[model samples]
Target: MGKPTGFMEYERSVSHAEKPKERIKHFNEFHQPLSMEERKCQGARCMECGVPFCQSGIIIGGMASGCPINNLIPEWNDSIYRGNMKQALSRLMKTNNFPEFTGRVCPAPCEAACTCSLNGDAVAIKENELTIIEHAYEEGYFKPNPPKVRTGKKIAIIGSGPAGLSAADQLNKRGHSVTVYERSDRLGGLLMYGIPNMKLEKQIIKRRINIMKEEGITFVTKADIGGNYNAEEIMKSYDSVILACGASNPRDIKVPGREAKGIHFAVDYLKATTKDILDRNKTLTPDFKNFTITAKGKKVLVIGGGDTGNDCVGTAIRQGAISVVQLEMMPKLPDQRADNNPWPEWPKVAKTDYGQEEAISLYGEDPRVYQTTVREFIADEQGNVCKAKIVRLESKFNEESKRFMMEEIAGSEYEIEVDMVLIAAGFLGAQSYVADAFGVELDVRTNVKTDAGNYQTNVDNVFVAGDMHRGQSLVVWAIREGREAAKAVDTHIMGYSNL
Candidate 1:
């Protein structure tokens, strides 16, 4: 441990964020980093338990309980406390290939599973990590290290997202020639589009990508293997192919009037908006007429109550939406941790995400409408959605049937006028076209079929990882899969592996 009495001497202090009203006016990061002294104090709060459940990365109740990459949290905390930032960064990079991304976007399960959290407070591992990497960058500690020798083995990675990038980093480090292909014009997949700029800036992603490029990894953007380029042809050329395309197949609401022009998938909407931003910055064009979806002066109703839904809410608020309402199928959670949820576990409680804070500040009330679902959409003559009919639902467990069901409450039907509807119900699985093109088998959930121990697909030379193989999951989990898949590929190629 850094200090025997460090946990008791220093209290937890998290980074401060800008007020919602001020932050929503611009598309930039709102959370400000804590000072050097504050970060050291936060790192000192680490008890460094013998078990260290914060780095366990185990599954409990079908959800991730700690850091999925199993980062060396305690060691790094001690390093930071000793003012050894280079060693701290080295320890962090041992597991997580991209600390900068996770530090900003990850929910920090490590904090929730911390030993200190047993008393309702956790060590600020996330902030400490961000501080270490940012300090390393400023001190000129991070530099590109290309492989000393080439293995003459070529590998192709699809998607260029977190998973693919992680795999490329690992395989290239092992002396393999790695090439990452991305369908979009830019790399970083969801990091480039799905997530908003206010949460994770694009420049941060580009900075890391540049380092990876200097490390002898090739990035080919605007290259769609199953589309303009033949998947079979690419597979034939490369020694191995790793699919990390992610779960791109979005779940859609199949209700009446869904074909209306105003209805759109959340991913499509976010992608279009970010693409416009990038293109406009490149071309110096002032015209935004081609960007079809805009929330300006419109009543926006977001269907779903997850992170993506919150993203829609925040994006709409930034776009100057006249009003916003977020609908959730489940009831609201308690503000405090329930009795059944004990210490050292992620608390099942209600909290305001960034978007809800913005909405509440502007409207004087929270925008989330719990225990409600859309019954039908009412559209105008132009085939555009104008209003939504909703009904309250009551959830109950049927003892006889041994299952839970939702029943619409009587006389609880209500209507709200809305000019736009964003369906943020989340993804189902990976797109079918790529899997079909490669003739890969899929599980019942539509994810690529791979054994638990081995990430290899039915084809000998093909492997799968990330959401494409494991379903929609955390970015850290994707990075883990990518690293492991690279190991499996290296073993297959050289009859020995060092991953």
Candidate 2:
């Protein structure tokens, strides 16, 4: 309630994205933040309702309805409307430990559940949040303030992704010594490699890690907990251990010629490109004269149409891919939400993500082919994938299971040139090595198992969070899980928890 009629008076405005063609030229962040005044106006769009669904953080109709971390959206929006960046950030950090990362990569379920979306465009909650944090950084609001006292207790966090970082931050602030171990040569786990630079520049992650180091959190890299390091030794050393290693085991499609050399998991392919970018200190627009797994001049076929697949499409185009086709098992969704997908529920609609936009701009066609899948990979004399046999699929009701299932359509198989294939069919579960080494049990889905609504593992003094505890999910959800897991660990150690 900065202004009673603020919602009516101001129209929602968000940050502008660079032209697709121009942005694809560099592997860097493309969205330009709005000016302070403009962002303040956007903040004015918050209605501040009696029951603000924006922060409810509940599931409705089998989908997440609002901010999973329960951010105080209205309060921060009011702070912004009144030009109080400090207050805005203060309210923001109360719940979310890393607004900077969420503001960039999150899908913004808060906006989807906004009351304003019932009638008009939703408030630019994400950008307003980004503005608050970025402004805080530009100013001197962020400071490395270590805990004044130590609890004489030590904890080990396996993984340096969002979840592990947040958990380490919380426990360290609670006066407990925290150490995070990452198997990767660099820290941030997937943030360092799996994600492309254009979405989130690597420097931002470095900035946060540097501050955490100053705040008395220790990070160990190239430490493979289950393989190189002894899990039993770690259990003996730490008062408590938190496993935040994300679900890194990617699901693979079983098809003929799956062993072809040109076929790779999406995670590995993205990591290769990112590592090359970081090593070269610049975006190397590849000019591959021969097949080196880089997408230069390759006719690429991406399996699955999730965010990862879209990322592959974008990355390949930037690496000078001659052509790209994305296959989805499900059919394309409607441009607008259907009647079943009412407001306040997650809207089921087709979204053209940035990568697809780039592909369309350059290729003059959407690279995604819905309701189709790869039947086989056709390899050349050298046993490298040369083309893919695609088969169209149709949804049919199964009488026995009483569910819809996708079946291959008859006489719908076709072949197209494909020098590279990236499978982005989502993740199955956490890698079994870490859990096996620790003797942690796994659920039916292969996620680390625990009692429902609990973070404690079967073993004493061991806890789990993030993708390892749940499944592959957003960074925002991972942070929430880590914070919650920290609370459980703190309680077990101190006899009572105040996290």
Q: lDDT values of the candidates?
A: 0.88, 0.91
How does model 2 score by TM-score?
0.98
Give candidate 1 misplaced runs (Cα > 4 Å). Answer: 282-291, 398-401
lDDT of 1 by residue, 1-499 (tens): 8887889998888889999888877777888888887788878888888999999898787667789899999999998888888899999999999999899889898888998888758889888888988898888989898999999999999988888999999999999999999999999988889987778888899999999999999999988878987999889889999999999999989888888878888988888777776776632122334455788889999999988899999988878889999999989999987888765667788989999999999988999999999989999998889999999999989898999887799999999999999999989897899998888999999999988768899987999989898888778888999999999999999999988
RMSD of each: 2.0, 1.4
Error of 1 at 348 (Å): 1.7
Error at 152, model 2, angstroms: 0.9
Distance from true location, Cα of 79 in model 1, Å: 0.9
In candidate 1, list every pair of residues with a backbone clash.
none
Among the numbered candidates, top lDDT falls to 2
Off by over 4 Å in 2: 285-292
